[model samples]
Target: MADPTLPRADEAPGTIAAQVNKGQQFTSFDVNAFEIPNQREEVWRFTPFRRLRGLHDGTAVRTADPSIVVDGVTDGVTVETVGRDDQRLAEGGAPFDRVAAQAFSSFTDATVITVAKETELAEPVFVKVDGPGAGEVGFGHIQIRLEAFARAVIVLDQQGSGTYAENVQFVVGDHAHLTVVNVHDWADDAVHVAAHHIGVGRDAIVRHFAVSLGG
Candidate 1:
């Protein structure tokens, strides 16, 4: 089945997907909703557009699909790959940036991690997300959902090479506790643009850590 989030027939297959703007006024699942960023824009003034490897301008086409796998499944935790139409997607929030929206609207599938309500895992779940290759480009998304009163630790190890853009959502349920670590260790020439959207629920606690091993 075609994922609802993917571009429609009239829409270019992988380009111009996003409705959000520079001012952050509105958001949508459509790609044409966003304007391509240039060196002149305030939000983009400091970004090296050339270094993006065409992800921002829609010139980069996905050369490969990302490979996501977990070290092991712990009790009370379920990891599944779901289509973009999955209701659980974007639970934390909608795409707030053009790149983020593009990633959301372009990805065919998403990795969803769910911690059952009130269940605590004995060990952390390690997820490894690998990109296509050094010269390739790809778009992807991942989501972590914690049910009410649950507690868990997650380690996201992102590696491999390529020009990659992605969005990650963390939805913490009421009274749940979550701690996450994200490590970026791509090849020296690789390019990556990513957004991490976190939504903390009532009485929920979340701790996040990021490590960039490659400059």
Candidate 2:
């Protein structure tokens, strides 16, 4: 699905940056409620504006964290949390389009997922991010990475009890092997927006699996 957090016609780029700066960013609203502009807009044509909103209103929901557990790990998999400015994130000139990145980055100081550089591994790493609703707003960021020849599976499971919005991002390295599974078990009223940007280095492969259980 096209991320709901993407920009709308009325929202200016500078306005968006200001909102991010003030920490008053928008959540994963139902995208269908908005209108799709003509070809003048760069990213609108390829998007599914109708299905983007789905069949629900997500503004008033609360936040809930999804549950996750690392059931298995092999020798090739090593999991570590690195600084947000680690080498991988810096390698890409700009991982995300300026506005969207600033929206989530402004509110979040630390990234939840970080894999160290040159870390060799043989197993899978499971990461779960879930939030329960409180009839308010909830925003956060998650980042992931793999060094050269690093092999592993990263699983992301997201759920919400009330209604909430969330932002996420992931990265992969050259010759690195990564498999990611994302499960969305959100309440009907919840709005979830997760952004994943992966860089496949030479001879590196990353696989993704996403399942929407509820909502």
Model 1 agreement with the true structure over 82-187: per-residue lDDT tens digits: 9987877746677656788778877878999999999998888898999877777788889999999999999999999888899899999999999999999987
The 10 consecutive residues of candidate 2 with the worst lDDT sum are 54-63
How far in Å is the alpha carbon of 20 misplaced in model 2?
Answer: 26
C-alpha RMSD by candidate, in order: 6.1, 9.7
Lowest summed lDDT window (length 10), candidate 1: 12-21
TM-score of every model versus the real structure: 0.85, 0.56
Report how far off residue 10 is in candidate 1 (Å): 15
Off by over 4 Å in 1: 1-25
lDDT of each: 0.82, 0.50
For the record, the alpha-carbon RMSD of candidate 2 to the native fold, in angstroms, is 9.7
Clashes of each: 4, 23
lDDT of 1 at 60: 80
In model 2, how many backbone clashes occur? 23
**lDDT of candidate 2?**
0.50
